[model samples]
Target: MADFTTFLHFPISRCGIHVHESCYGGLPVADPEETRWFCEPCQYGLIEPPHCEFCPSRFGAFKRADISGRWAHAVCSLYTHGVTWSQEHTTTGVSWENLENSVFGRRVCTACSDKIEARFGVASRCESGMCKEYMHVTCAQKLGLLVDETDESDDVIVAVPRYFFCKKHTNQENLKTFQRRFEQWEKAEGRRITVHRRKKALSGAEDALRIQMRETLEETIREEDRGKSNGSVAGGEKIKQARLLNSSTEFFDRFETKAEDSGLSKKEFRDPFYDIKLTNASHVPIGFSKEYIE
Candidate 1:
């Protein structure tokens, strides 16, 4: 089974992976194994590819303007603000050669491609789904995926949400409220995030054991809290706690595979080879009955 790091060597020798915001940070590689190759960076969803600087995205198409002058992505330049480069000169003008190499063969930027889409609309996509015409990087940014680089090499991109109002449509007053909600998610789900990190760093059955232990610990804590609050303890719970405290190798037959995506074969899910995705937080609905909460 090919892993996330696997790349292809066929009709499409994709040099690098292209990731859009809606599709998470970006696909690590263009392989069929990761059918759902998406990142779940908690706050940020998917990242998108950067547009060619020569495109009409924001500054308007300045094609053939002077491949003479060295160019750089807007985001990269931002970091090197105030640095000056001359035109026609190699190192003198273009401080960022990596970006210059991107347009070497003269590729069009997302801006011009978008115009073509406008004149003869093309398909564009983001979290909200697909778009009819080609939108500038700015338009895509407005939609959510804020591309920092306007270079060529950068293929994969991350999608950033617009103003935090897309999902909940929160007003200024609600911003802090939403922040608190996310903070709570982080606090309660910190271990989950760690689990995700470990999954990426480690693989195979060892990773599976880590996840199982995390879940088991979380469950134990919840149960302990519940018992303390209710002033009552179940007889079995004592045995469970004792087992948990005994050792970390308490498999207790909690092994075997778990199917992540549907239609995938019955391969045992010993542990995921890639990073774990956290689509939504583990939170109770706002308006649950008191009895339900209890």
Candidate 2:
């Protein structure tokens, strides 16, 4: 007699697997000892419409496969049942939430895939089950995920079901907030006045985003410049550099203009003018050249 662990989360307990079924919502049948389960008593079983892998709660129940060595959950297997190995990559450490929708074909992250769809109003998916990413057809192009690839169909990568999400997507309350917001948005979009207001808001947001990007770039450039100068002298050096550049530009502008107007470029003015005497004959007049020539 094997002891059944009752410490199972929702639908997966040892009682659900081996021992008494009815304990923790497990309907494991003791009749044939084959562990047969009907829908009426399943702990996490869905009803009617098929339970989508992307949805938190699906409509219909999924039949657990006895894949022998496959110990992954029914939800995990339903989407990514075939993937065997995983490769590592440098990523932003964001989690993916499965989005439950008809257009996205039942298996895409809720936050990334659904938000993009809702915002962009487009629908598309990757080539196959192993591709593991979704986007609006245009966004996929914008984000550089998919671009003219006839050979893309041949490349096979393992698609693991990702349940992870960024901070925004992780909070159920926050998601509800967003849902409410979008609902309001949909209602508001119906009106011309609201549309105008939304356009203004979006414009302001774009402007803010541009400003933020500029600030970030400027800060990064400043940090790089400071890094190149060793901390001790960098600040002083930067000030001196600014002053030097200011003075040089002011002084050279007159010379540059004269040189250009004289039908000569700066490069042309260099070596020839180096040999030609540039004198400030403040006291000496141009007529003094007559004495020398005569």
Candidate 3:
């Protein structure tokens, strides 16, 4: 099923485009006449992408809801603490309501070693629950932080980090934890593949078995007919019943044999990640935290 909550489609003049809720929130509210609503790209006849007001980037830019002719990246606005949308659905207003300058002023980008300037650069915080580190969007990308970019639409590319651990947190222990998780995933994948192959083979075997059973039944009926012609109908009926019962037993036995051969009767496959308990209220995954499940 399509997740309607994640995205919304808006008709911009003649062109229609699907945008994320966060991105849509940053856009200016549509005029009374919906037909007059046009995106920045269509509104301004610009060949090049518009620069973001918050960051020095052209990608994933959305018009600031309050400020006319000003734009900011959805990722930039989201990670920037105190920034919020006015509406419940986030379809209209975007503003930095009750923004604490102390937090913004104090945050020094770990990647670039620069202070996060006011109303210009947004700081993306470290993924570690206890860490108080932050980094700029471009700086994070340049420093090889796990930046995940998703193509939201043909024109919009939403880029954000999957996880951004500070230099202090990025250690051998975390690497080992990641490796362990990956190994578990590989094992799960292997089990799935084996199960699929076994099912396919079992299906083929059942088909063949059905054909054989049909042939046996046809032969038995022919033999019964011959016996009837020779005046031995009662004997033929007993033989036919015995053969039918045997065939039924053999069919069930094949299923048990297949199950044993596939090793499905042993231990069932289960995802290892689900067993892990959250270490803190932040709900950071096992590999990303210091106190992860072994």
Question: Which is the better candidate, 1 or 2, if ranked by TM-score?
Answer: 1
Going through the candidates in the order shown, the clash numbers are 24, 7, 0
What is the C-alpha lDDT profile of model 2 across 1-294, one tens digit per residue?
Answer: 001223222332111222222111222232343322232212222222222222222212232211111112222222232322111121101111122112222223323432212222112345454544444332222222322211212344233342322232222233444445445543532452333223322245434433443344334434544554467653523221111110121223345578789998866744342332212222334242411110
Q: Of the pair 1 and 2, which is ahead by lDDT? A: 2
TM for every model, in the order presented, reads 0.19, 0.17, 0.36
Preferred candidate (TM-score higher): 2 or 3: 3
Off by over 4 Å in 3: 1-38, 44-48, 102-106, 113-120, 137-294
In the order shown, the candidates' Cα RMSDs to the true structure are 24.6, 28.9, 30.2
Q: Write the per-residue lDDT of candidate 3 for residues 199-289, one digit (tens) a residue.
A: 3222454344334433443344444345444855544332211111111212223444675687855223112222333212233332523
Candidate 2 residue runs with Cα over 4 Å from true position: 1-28, 33-36, 39-41, 44-53, 62-76, 81-294
Global CA lDDT of candidate 1, please? 0.26
lDDT of 2 at 215: 43
**By TM-score: ranked, best first:** 3, 1, 2
- Whole-structure CA lDDT of model 2: 0.28
